[model samples]
Target: MRLLSTIMLALFLVFSMSGAVLAQEAQTNTTDPIIVGNQDAESLQVVQSYFETMDSNLLAEDVSYFDEQSIQAIEGRDMLTQSPTFMYGDSFTEQQLTPLRYIVTEDVVVVEYTFVGRNTGSYATLPATNQLVSVPTVGIYHVEDGQITGIREYMDSDDLYTQLGYPAYTGVQPVAPFTLPEPNAVDDIVDNPPAFYGQEVTIEGGFGEMVGPNAFTLWDEDFIDIGQEGLLVLAASDGAFDFTPVEETMLRVTGTVYEYDRASLEGTVGYALDEGTFTDYQNFTVLVASEIANMDNVDTLANVDQQPESFYGQTVTLEGHIGDTVGDSAFVLFRDQLVGVGGRVLVIAPDFDPATVENNQVQVTGVVQPVDAPTIVTETGLTLDENLLSDYQDWTALIANEVMSVE
Candidate 1:
């Protein structure tokens, strides 16, 4: 009887331990889908299908995935109504979005993927020629209650531009060759016939005959006049000419050779009529300003108050010291130019450093306006524009947009 009782107790303890183990296993299965193999596979399959549908939409005319409440960082808008992912004038006929990996965390799922699009039309007015531009991107999607509430993407712009064959810069070409003309006189060139038009020519003489903003001529020691004849003027494409802002200095020019009517000359040379005409000239010009000249083009608070309506959308130049940062942006202005008592002009750049540009006297050509206090505060809480964020990833590529030469 005693042996039987001991056997029964041992059996009961074993059964109780087994029951506890089974209950713990069930609890874990309920908590984590991966460990228990319950619903993760089904959930992932649905998510994958959703992504596949999104890829189809990207290729088709439908952009419903970016419906209302969808904030696009690249377009700097909250919805797809204002910012379309498709190129400005192009339509996507085929695309492939291959998921490289999917990392599921506690509350978010990160989808790593490669996107290849066969572009068939002009992208931002640039000919696409049906080229395939493959871009790798990583997207983080916040999943709560089985729905995505937010998304962020990271990618490169240089890869996109290289695939498109667009020039990355809109500024003046900085490097070119120039030699000082011998005999130090502009009169020699005017008196002597130009050997060639659009040919590399060297001129030497004191700066003379100031023309428009950046237009000037040279004169020989004997004061012989060398005008626009045989000279090529390198003008800014944006129509904003930068010069030394000083007078009477000897300089040399090596650029495309061109001829303009003497009567039609606005300054030193007439504008090139075509791409072929301007091809030989240096794309940019350099000014050797030794002193500060009157920068009347820049607007001031006092001036704006006096003529409030005139300052709207007008591109003005300014110089000033750096001030406190508003998020990643900064404000700057000279003490003399500050409005009220110690108020400075606000300069907003997402990734600009006041220390790098402060007191350095940069020539900024942008519109001046009053800061919207509410907007500034609101922007801090909002996510960054995806397109603007992409610009930081690749320094060599220009942001994708319709950029016309301001010249």
Candidate 2:
């Protein structure tokens, strides 16, 4: 069972044997089927169960498919159960596998399938690339007497990592999470993030630093310093409590994950939206904490200045001399009132009727979320069209969850 996993990443037929694929190509009901004997039919069933267990991430602790006398040449049954072949679900939000071919002989069953999913989570030791991949793999199972005796699997690892947007593994395993996901890890939100959209979950991870009045970055234990792409969290709890930064061991219950729509406004005032895109989605797993506590000894959270680009996804407070307005709801705050080249933070409050913030001094509190950054798109197959910050427009800002205390 352990040795039989790689079949999902193996065979990738450039084209089907014919222009038309045989949908009902079953050998059982028809005169031409792959079944040989009763054992052959059962072996096929066993192989199917193996893939099902893998997809569900419920690898049996005691591998019943292989006994002590099993000749698992490539690896042992226990190793296979915990092996990378079975760990695909750990990093991917969705791994949809569909069988392509099944070549069954007397005692051996070889199967082919295509594995398609977005790489949103990390491998054992590697970080997530947040890319999508679709590839074919081959799996072989050897049945002797009754139980599976041997197994062989092949996955196209040469460019699989590159395709999935991750560096090849170098014998490193991903760091274990402090607390199990109410289903997934913190970094798991990167790829196929929309899968967890609108779902209420409790996630745990390290406290990277504080971003704003009540916003902070929750770092994945494996890649602590990776960046602001995945670890931004906002507290939905009462403002009475202040969150202190600590190690990767805090818990959040109201974590709501969402993605930003970059091209929402282009021709609007001071708005230059990037139209071209690369990745299908760029997500941030946010948490409005119902409850939070620091398990570490550190009491200080790293403070970032009014650097909106640097503080993307962080909740920061800015006291600036107000400047101008864009539309009915959005206004500008010129922190650098003299030079004005340092750029400005756009404050949009549509809920606040009859928008009334003047060019006076005021305190702004909100998340410094990125509006337009670099994005990846495909011109053709391998041809990539990258959208950089300078390519369109750039001005990360404090999206005011609440703007108050005008002075």
Query: Which candidate number has the best lDDT?
Result: 2
C-alpha TM-score for every candidate:
0.30, 0.29
Give the per-residue lDDT digits (tens) of candidate 1, residues 1-407: 11222333353335334554456556654333222112364334444665767532222132122211112122212343344452221334477777655545444444556778877866545666677778765554444444444444454444666776765533333222223232223333444434444344445444544444444444442222111232334342324344563444434443433444433322334343344433443321222222222222225433443453567555654323333433454334322211111113455454444444311233334554445434433543434344433322321111111111111
Local error of candidate 1 at 187, Å? 69
lDDT of residue 263 for candidate 1: 30
Give residue 315's lDDT in candidate 1 (0 to 100). Answer: 60
Q: Global CA lDDT of candidate 2, please?
A: 0.47
**Candidate 1: minimum summed lDDT over ten consecutive residues — where?**
398-407
lDDT of 2 by residue, 1-407 (tens): 11122222322232223233244443244433322224337667666666566432232232323211122222445766555535363677677776666655555566666678878777545788778888666655665444565554556663577686656534322222122225355766654667876666666566655554455666554322312365456545334346445544444434566544434212111233223331222355454455565523211111223344466666666555444554444456543311111235555544442234321445667766644322211111222222322332455544566655342
TM-score of 2: 0.29
For model 1, the superposed segments whose C-alpha errors exceed 4 Å read: 1-46, 55-78, 86-91, 167-407
Off by over 4 Å in 2: 1-40, 53-76, 84-89, 166-407
Global lDDT of model 1: 0.39
